[model samples]
Target: MQAGAGQTPARRSRRRSPVPFLIAWIVIIMMGTAGAWLYSEHMKQQITAQIEAQTARQIAAMENNYEQRIKELDAGYSSQIAKLQSEVDSLNELLTFTKDNASNKTDNSNKLYTQLSQVQKQLDELKRKLDMLK
Candidate 1:
C-alpha cells in the first residue's frame, strides 16, 4: 500500500480532557495548604510553651530574691535590737549606783549639821559663865 493511500489518514489526535489535571492540581494545592496550616499551628504551640516556661522561671527567681532580702533585713533588725537592749541595761545600772550615792550624801550632811549646832550651844554657855564672874 502506498504509505498514505491505503490507510485512512490518522485521525487527528483526540484532545485530552483538562478536567483530571485540574482536579489533580486542586487536590495538590489543598494538601499543601493543610500542611502549611498544621506546621504553623505546631510552631505557635511551641512558642507559647516556651514563653510560659520562661515566665515561670523568672517569677521563681524573683520570689527567691525577695525571700533572701527579707531574711537579711530580719537579721539586721534583730542585731540592732540586741544592741539597744544592752545599752538600756548599762544605763539602768548606772542610774541605780547614782541614786545610792545621793542618799548617802544626804545622810552625811544631816549628821554634820547636828554636830555644828551642839558645838555652838556649848560655846554660848561658857561665855555666860565668864561674864557673871566679872
Candidate 2:
C-alpha cells in the first residue's frame, strides 16, 4: 500500500514476547500448587484429630474395665476376710473347751488314786488267809 502524502508509513504492531506469558503461567501454577498443599495439610490435620478422638475413647473404655475388675476383686477380698474371721473365732472356742476339760481331769485324778490304794490293801489280806488254809 502507498503511504498518504502527509501520513507516515504504518508501523507494524509489536508482537508480545513469550517471557511475560511464561511468567503469568508460572504464577498460576505456583498458586495452584500452594492451594493443593494447603488442602492436603488441612486433610492431614483432620485425620490426626479423628485418630486422637478414637484413641481417647479406647483409653476410657479400658479404664472403665479396669475399675470394674478392681471393684470385683475388692468385694471378693472382703468376703474372704469375713469368712476367715469366723473360722478364727470357731478355733478359739475349740481351744477354750480343751483348756476347761484339762482342768476337770486334774480334779478327778485324786479320787482315782484313793480308790487304787484301798484295793491294794484288801488284796494283801486275802493272800494271808489263803496261805493259812493251805
Candidate 3:
C-alpha cells in the first residue's frame, strides 16, 4: 500500500460486508413491486367506473327512445278512435232521418212497405261502403 504525504504506508481498508447491502436491495425491490401493484389496482378501478358510466348513459337513451315510440303509438290510436267515432255518428244520423220519415207514412200499408224497403236498401249500400273502407 502507498503512503499518503509523509504518513507511513497505510493498511488496506476493511471491505464492507455484503449481507446488509443485499438485504437493503431486496427491501427496495419489494417496495417497488408493491407500489406497482397498487398503481395497477387503482387504474383498474378507474376503468371500471368509466365503463359503468357509459352503460348508464346508454340505458337512459334507450328508455327515452321507448317513451317517444309509445307517445307516437298513442297519438296514432287516438286518431283512429276519432275517425271511428265520426263514422258511428254519421250512421246514427242516417238512422234517425229514416225513422222520422217512416213515422209520417200514409194510411195505405203499401206506401209504408215501399218506404221501409227503400230505407233497407240505403242501409245495405251504406254498410257496403263502410266494409270497403275497412
Among these predictions, the greatest lDDT belongs to 3
Question: Lowest summed-lDDT stretch of 10 residues in model 2?
Answer: 125-134
What is the lDDT of every predicted structure here? 0.67, 0.67, 0.70
Distance from true position, residue 113, model 1, in Å?
34
Model 3: per-residue Cα lDDT over 51-104, one tens digit each? 999999999999999878767766665565556556556655655665677755
How do the residues 2-85 of candidate 2 rate in per-residue lDDT, one tens digit apiece? 877666677645798999999999999999999999999999999999999999999999999987876776566556555555
TM-score of each: 0.55, 0.62, 0.53
How many pairs collide in each candidate, listed in order? 0, 0, 0
Scored against the true structure, residue 74 in model 2 reaches a CA lDDT of 59
Poorly placed runs, candidate 3 (over 4 Å): 1-18, 92-134
The Cα error of candidate 3 at residue 109, in Å, is 21
Q: lDDT tens string, model 1, 70-123?
A: 677666655655555555455555545655677667555455445544544554
* Ordering by lDDT: 3, 1, 2
- Model 1 — TM-score against the truth? 0.55
Clashes of 3: 0
- Per-residue error for 59 in candidate 2, Å, reads 0.8
Superposed on all Cα atoms, the candidates' RMSDs to the truth, in angstroms, are 26.1, 25.5, 11.0
Residue 44 in model 2: lDDT: 100
